[model samples]
Target: INKDTFHLSQRDTENHQTNLQKFCRICGGSFKSDPYKRSYPVHGPVDDDTQALLRKKEKRATSWPDLLAKVFKVDVRGDIDTIHPTNFCHNCWNMIQRKFSNSPSEVYFPREGTMEWHPHSSSCDVCGTSFRGIKRKKRSLNPQLSKKPRMVAGSARKARPVRNVKQVSNKAVMKRIANCNKIHLSTKILAVDYPVDFVKSVSCQVCEHILADPVETTCKHLFCRACVLKCIKAMGSYCPACRYPCFPTDLVSPVKSFLNILNNLILRCPVKDCQEEVVLGKYAHHFSSHKEAEEKEGYAYINKGGRPRQHLLSLTRRAQKHRLRELKLQVKAFAEKEEEGDVKSVCLTLFLLALRARNEHRQADELEAIMQGKGSGLHPAVCLAIRVNTFLSCSQY
Candidate 1:
């Protein structure tokens, strides 16, 4: 293992399902013969590095206030009526109804010790609503056995109790099972229990205006989709309440229903001094049109391998011209020195200037090259050398 440490080795020894070690009969020392069983010393102590990294991680963890701002921008305590564990009041029930509109929903009834699944019965509750509920089976092991069922003799089949023999179809049971499986698969595929178009009745806690369908954040916080978008545009791209990291694409949902809701409730334009409303369907297009979009896109294009935006190409061209102008000025000074007959000084000055200029020009050239969508292998020296060779060759000619 020590010899193999510096060099790469692929060792595979698998077949054995169990291992038995030999014990010395005299000393009782257990032995493992395999070299892989031995432990080696690590190069250095990692406590300091680990501590520093841990500190950095803790720093990265968002504060509660920041998180709350992103998600619960409005007062959650105010909006969600507090309910006792025994039962949900009308307000909490209304909130749940507003959140999840379809398929009967209910709350936990602590008194009954069960999750109420049935919709509140309207006749029973006098609110014209039935408390939706589903009973869960309580199971336990009992030491005592109940009385055994008596078996009847096969010959006495005619003596069996004669009554109405209602024939039941097996297909009906199979259909029920199939329906259950379909529901299970659908929930699995979507990863969330989505209520259909229920967000419409939900209102912003701050504005008190009925929300135009809500968007679900990964943290499970709900918001008027447009309101959150506006918040992001106003703030530096982060989750409104928690300052959780986010991206425009993070809002996408695979399910058509959720996507449709998102499409219907997009935020207004996030630009400062601009009060234009951004329709849900047109958000992507609008964000793409921002003044900084091309610049940001250019950075992504060069460093992140995305397509360069049009404005980025223009900016790069302008920067290249500026670099070319600076290079010409230095070259002019070199010519003036050369004409004064100070050949060694002129050459040395030119060489140093070329080296320094190359570094500055490289940055500009990289911008240009990325704008042109070229690979990064080309060097500033190659371009500089070409210019020098051209000058030398022309002078000789």
Candidate 2:
């Protein structure tokens, strides 16, 4: 046995019957070693994309394994626990979903998890590479153990991801995890279990909870960051409390003194068996020590990634600000082409970007909104060009 790290390697060497579970049968990509790439069995109905496509294409619905066997001549019927079952990584699954043929547009590579896959070619028909251990002079351990994948496609049966208790049990981490879903965050959060009568003025109208990451509107109404966004979407771009027309850029942070009140609120840890009470302003400082949680959460920023959700929220806001800058530049450049309706084109394009590319069609929508006195605000770069005014962003635009 090697000294520094004892014989878990020995156990893995001696075990057998599960060596192939580490790879995707279609691509031969290694997901088990990296833990980030999404993997799924070829045996069952996986996602809505698969189901909808199956319903539209075939009169009789079939499991993925059945479909793969029929179309690709690849068989994956054996269960992994007993035999070497075929599986597919997310990229390979997408290729099959988009087209059902002998040749796919792209062929996933054996080292795909570490490197990019190649575009389809005639030689790719063989898909000729796979990495396997030689079994060697000493009987190598091939331990049979199920690993909880980061993302699996189906809900009917899914493995729960394991969390390190030691990581979650650390004092600083326990404090952060305790407040992960509980404290001030960008998205509309669950109502606090504790009373909020003292901070009633800042409570979100939709959630009836103390405002966490509050947003101030052009109409002077206040709401939790996601609460206002969701409300406006539901109300067809109208403000939550008032019917005043609003756009995403119209939501700014509250004034410094007003915000300082919310930031100063002391939160008692609501998670069970924890006694840490921390100031909202200082809560973020403790987050750096929680690297273990970061490893499990991976590179995602969504709330389901769990602890340090606030930090992720901050990152998301920064990315949006960057997007806003790009959008401003794109609008300014595109608007100059339609110089006759330059101001209106910039306004309408920012809102109806997903609509038709024709400027005339968008100009009509902008004219209607203008007639109704619902013109959206302009980005700072073009603020002088258009006759629109903006409130100073407390968080700094």
Error of 1 at 24 (Å): 59
- Prediction 1 TM-score vs. true: 0.19
lDDT for residue 191 in candidate 2, whole number 0-100: 30
Tens digits of per-residue lDDT for model 1, 1-397: 7768434321211101011112111111223332433211112122343335435546331232232233223222222111101112232222222222222333221222212122222232211111122234465545575754455787467655443221123223322322333111111122223464443323332122333345554434445556556555654445444344444544533346655654555355646766566555665577668857768877663545666544524667677667468666776676676566554455554554564466555544444344446755567786565445545866621
lDDT per residue as tens, model 2, 46-95: 56777777777663545777766543446566444433434567766755
| Stretches > 4 Å off in candidate 2 | 1-197, 285-397
At residue 270, give the lDDT of candidate 1: 47
Predicted model with the maximum TM-score: 2
Deviation (Å) of 262 in candidate 1: 3.3
